[model samples]
Target: MSEPAAPADTIPHGDPFAIFEDWFAEARVTEPNDPNAMALATATPDGRPSVRMVLLKGHGPDGFVFYTNFESRKGHELAANGHVALLFHWKSLRRQIRIEGPISEVTPAEADAYFASRHPESRLGSAASDQSRPLENRQVYLDRVAAVRALYPDGNVPRPAHWSGYCVRPEAIEFWHDREFRLHERRRFVQSADGGWTSTMLYP
Candidate 1:
C-alpha cells in the first residue's frame, strides 16, 4: 500500500521533538509491527561502525532512550565513542527520522523501574541472556534461564547491574517524508547555543 500523499505541510515547522511525537503517534496506529523499533548506529574508537535494531523504550525532551547490557558490543562502542546516530523508519507511513547525538546513561533507579515493569518471562530471559556474546549451544542459554528461574522462583528477577539504558541528547534532528514522483521532503534542525533549534531544509 502507498503512503498517504504528503502535502507541503507534511513536514511541520517548530520543535522537532513535537513533530516526532505527532508522527510517532500516527505510526503507532499504522505500523503492523513494533512501531518503536529504530536503527541504532554506534562506532568504536577506531572508527569501525555497527548498526542494530533496538526498541525506543523511552523518549521526551531529554532525548531517545534504549536499553541494553552495558557489557554488550554496542554498549562498549558507546562507551568508547559517545557520538551516535539513530534512524526511525515507519514504512507504513513512509516517514523517517534521523537523529545524531551524544549518549548518556540513564539513572540506575530508572533502569530498575523499567526492568521491573517488564513481563516475568521477559525479565527472566533478559536476566539470563548474555547479549552480544557468543554461546556454545542453545541449551546453554536455556540452562542459564532455568537456573535463574530456580533461584527466583517467583520470577522477580532483579535488573542486572550491566543491563541499563542510554539517552541520546540530540544535537541534530532531520525529518524525512515520502512524496509522489520521487520528490521527497527533508527538514533539519540543529541545536543552538541557547538550547533552541535552528531549522533548515535540504533538497531531497
Candidate 2:
C-alpha cells in the first residue's frame, strides 16, 4: 500500500528546485516505471498545441533537458516558438509539477555524450529514425536500422546533426499535492528579475 500523504503544513517552501529534487527522489522509489518521464507541451507558431511524453534526461537548477530530432514535429515547433511547458505526474505519490519556460539548445558535446551512453540498439534506432515523418511500412524502418547497423556494427553510430537536446529555463513552476476530501495543496513559484523566486499559495 502507498504511504499516507504528508500534512499540508509540511509542504516545503522556498528554493523550488530543492523541493523538486526531494519529491523527485521519492518518486524514483515509488513510481512503478519511468519516474523520469514528463509530458512536454509545445505549440506551433500559430498556436496549435501538442503534448507528448519524453524522458527527463538531465535536470538541475539550470533546467530540465530532453533530446530529440531537431527536425521532428515538437522540435520544429520548439524552433519556431522557444517557449514550452512540462508536466511531471507521479501517480504513486499523487503529486505533479508543472513548469513553464523558454528553451535553449544543449551543447553539441552534451548531445554527443548522451547519444553515446544509450544502449547499442537504442543508438541504432534513433540514428535511423526520421522522426515525425510518414513511413511507408515497418520494414522500411527496419531496413534503415539494418543499413545503419551494418555501417557501424560496433553500434558507434554518430549522432545526427539534427539530433540534440533542449534545456527548459523555467520562468514559473507549480507543485501540486493531492489530499483527501477533494481538497488539495498548491504552491507556485515564479522567477524574479533578481534571479530568485517568489512563491504564492493557490486555493485548491
Candidate 3:
C-alpha cells in the first residue's frame, strides 16, 4: 500500500515567500473568481481601522502591490500612517493568509505604465472618478465619464497624478488551513532582525 501524505499542519520550515507563491498559484487554479482579491486594512493615526477589498496587481520579494486614487480614504490614511495589513481567504480551498506590513508608493513611471495597460473604458472611469468622495448623483459621475471619453477619443488617457500604487513590505505572514473535525492548522512567519524568517505553529 502507498504511504499516506503528510498532514497540512506539518508544513515544512522554509522560505515563506516561496510558500506564499505556491499557495497563491493553487488558489488561482481553484478559485472561481478573482483569486487575486484580498482585503486591505488601514488605520487612522489615532487608531480607528478600516478595511476593503482590492485586487493584487503584483507581488515579489519587495512586497504586494495594489493601485488606487491617492486622494481616497485609503490614500489619506496611508499618507498619514504607512502601517497596514492584508488578508487573503480562498473559500474553495479552505485556506487563508494574513500579512502585516508598512507600505510605500510606487514610482510615477510604474503607475503610468500600469494605467496604460488598463482597458480604455477602465482608464476613462478611473481618470474621472473622485474616489471615496460623496457624489451629488449617478448622472453627475456618468457625465464626468462622458467628458473624459470626449477628451480621449483615441483612448490615450494620461494617468491622473492622484492615481498610483502602493507596495506593502511584509513584517510577518501567517497561513491557516482547515482540517478535519475543526482541527485547523495555523503557521506564522515573522521576519527576524538579521533578515531571516522564524516560523511558529499556533493553536487552532
Q: Any runs in candidate 1 off by more than 4 Å, and if so which?
A: 1-9
Every model's TM-score: 0.95, 0.95, 0.95
- Identify the superior model by lDDT, candidate 1 or candidate 2: 2
lDDT of 2 by residue, 76-127 (tens): 8999999999999999999999999999999999999999998999988998
TM-score of 2: 0.95
The sequence of per-residue lDDT tens digits that candidate 1 reaches over residues 1-204 is: 998765675687799999999999999999999999999999999999999999999999899999998898998899899999999999999999999999999999999999999999989998998898999999999999999999998788999998999999999999999888878999999999999998898999
Model 1 misses residue 104 by how many Å? Answer: 0.5
Candidate 3 lDDT at 191 equals 95
| Least accurate 10 contiguous residues by lDDT in model 1 | 4-13
Candidate 1 clashes: the total is 0
- Candidate 3 has which clashing residue pairs, if any? none
Whole-model lDDT for model 3 versus the true structure? Answer: 0.94
Please give, for residues 1-204, the per-residue lDDT of candidate 3 as tens digits.
Answer: 996965665555798899899999999999999999999999999999999999999899899999999999999999999999999999998999999999999999999899999999999999999999999999999999999999988989999999999999999999898887888898999999998999999998
Model 1 C-alpha lDDT versus the unseen true structure: 0.93
